[model samples]
Target: MISKISSQRTRCKSWLLGGLFCAVACVAQSQAAGVTWSSQYQDRLFDSGGGVLDTQFSFEVGIFLPGFTPTASNVDLWESNWRTLDRAYDPTPEDPNDGDPEGWNVPEQFFVGYYQIEAGGYSSSPDADPLYAFPGGAQAYLWVYDSKSLDAPREWALLTDGITADNLADAWVVPDADAGSLEWYLEDLDVVIYGGGNDLQGPGGYTLDPVVFSLQTHSVAVPVPEPGSALLVGLTLGLAALLRRRGLSAARG
Candidate 1:
């Protein structure tokens, strides 16, 4: 009789502990997917090289849909105006005195989609033309620091065709053994409109407006926890202890 009662009590204790663990697991899963991404647009306005805007620019990034076609209205995210590099863009100079041009700013923020603009043609109209239609597709480019220091690059011009919006989304820089933090930068990206150089230069004298996309900083995706995982671990440990105790009890009997 005593053995049967003790066995029942052990089973009951295990059930109660397992139930409590499951409850805690349920709470963790709810928090992960429910949390949404948000941009701090309200705090800062889009600042173009020329000037800054009154209102904030809207933008977002999420799981890219399969065969996702980006439109102005259906834009998953938006970037603010471009930020111009204030200092002169002199990567290298023959003489020490020869400094970069003053008040020269390059567009850093505001990246355009793959087909947002034509290579040689003019105008990236967000309203009139919703999609950026590049006939032959386009290549994204940016100017990065030749050397680690911000002062200047040893080479004259260093173009970056590597970094893209899609790449940046999943991009991360890890600290290496030698160097502390490798420099991560996005130079200007190009969207190929028409193939030829003449097409880039419009009919009369109209200079094609650069279709630029912004390099906005974004948050990383967090892993969703499995509700049952923690509980399984706890239960496995408890079961092992219970089995050992049962064996001991039998031996005593």
Candidate 2:
């Protein structure tokens, strides 16, 4: 009988110790893990149509990818002061009969994204189509081809739609155009092919483009207790429990 009781006591003690050790270890480990990331691309703003006019081109950083899959969820309206330098600016029959322009110019660019989701929209041009290049259409996907790593010609996605030569300029916001301090997320990171129409083909059929921008990666340090510390904590709790049980038994006797 004594042997049996002793064995039970020993087992209880071990369990208590183990529990304590686990708790401690968990705390330690949680404090030890660390993470790092690359720099963030700044907002890019430049001119085109006249020539390969590019200046500030960069990407927004720290956006959670898995979360930003694609949806009308976060719609935002963008306005641009652009003019259709192309005199032959004609829309396809399928194109919505919104209105005819005397000539495409000032306050002509308007774009929407995450609009339905967030209930917001903007326009650079007063006379622009709401559905010009919506993500839900052929101009749905946005590609950020890593010019340095991937092949240029095949590694891009249709970021935004209404992205015509004229429309592209509509979205173009010069540094001076930034009303108040403006903050923009990098939407498209691609080589601005001077004349590459909506097709967006590469120069030499390479994987990536000369233009490359990236979002800043944000990280937080995770605390991970050392294995040894965890073990010790668990052991202490287990032992304490076992001892408490023994005391109760002794009182009953």
Candidate 3:
């Protein structure tokens, strides 16, 4: 009985210690980054749009790590943003007008996703039918293709944006030339993430937050914070650590 009890106690301690570290680290990191994770929300939630509560959407977004500070040598990381969400989705025409004067049409230049998904019952003449890409067509299914990268032209993550034209969108994610040689998101001299998706399925048709990245200090437990936010977090955490030590010592006595 004693052996069994001791084993159970050991497992309990292991779980408690592991859980605490993980929870603390995750919470701290999220706070430090202040990332706005991509998620489906009712258009009405933050809607300045008409009162429609459109809830369905597939979305992706990314923020490059602040200054590309951590693990700068990662080529794939350099090519892509620091964090991204390219959820798979496809738009199908289910309305009476398959794809014409009344669906969703934003110009090709505005999309954040690098690729596009053509909706069901697509029209050949995109110029005339500038509205819904698909009208009353078929059930939605996800399909993807690489909008860029001719060398490795494979289907990237599929998106749920409604029907769109096949032509590629104009590039907008230009590199900041002033960010020094280390910065690669160059608009003029560089490449990658050139264009984006536009005409969002949601009501507002645009992001509610600005894109930004937080620095990471992996060697230290505390995630690096934005310029003014770090000092307060550090002081509070230090005080908590001191109290924890005191409690542990008292328990031993």
Model 2 TM-score, all chains together: 0.19
* Deviation in Å, model 3, residue 244 alpha carbon: 67
lDDT of 2 by residue, 151-200 (tens): 12212111332343533122222222112232222333232222122234
Tell me the tens digit of each residue's lDDT in model 1 across 1-253: 9999999999999999999999977754332111111112222212212132211222211111234432223211211211111112322333323332221122222212111122322113332132322222222222112222223211111122233465423122211122222222232122211111111211111122222322221111223346799889899999999999999999999
Greater-TM-score candidate between 1 and 3:
1
Error of 1 at 156 (Å): 33
Assess candidate 1 and give its TM-score to the true structure: 0.24
List where candidate 2 sits over 4 angstroms from the true fold.
Answer: 32-145, 149-253
Cand. 3 Cα-lDDT: 0.29
Query: Each model's number of backbone clashes?
Result: 24, 67, 23
TM-score of each: 0.24, 0.19, 0.18
Tell me the deviation in Å of residue 108 in model 3.
Answer: 16
List all candidate RMSDs to the true structure. Answer: 31.0, 30.9, 27.2
Order the candidate numbers by lDDT, best to worst.
3, 2, 1
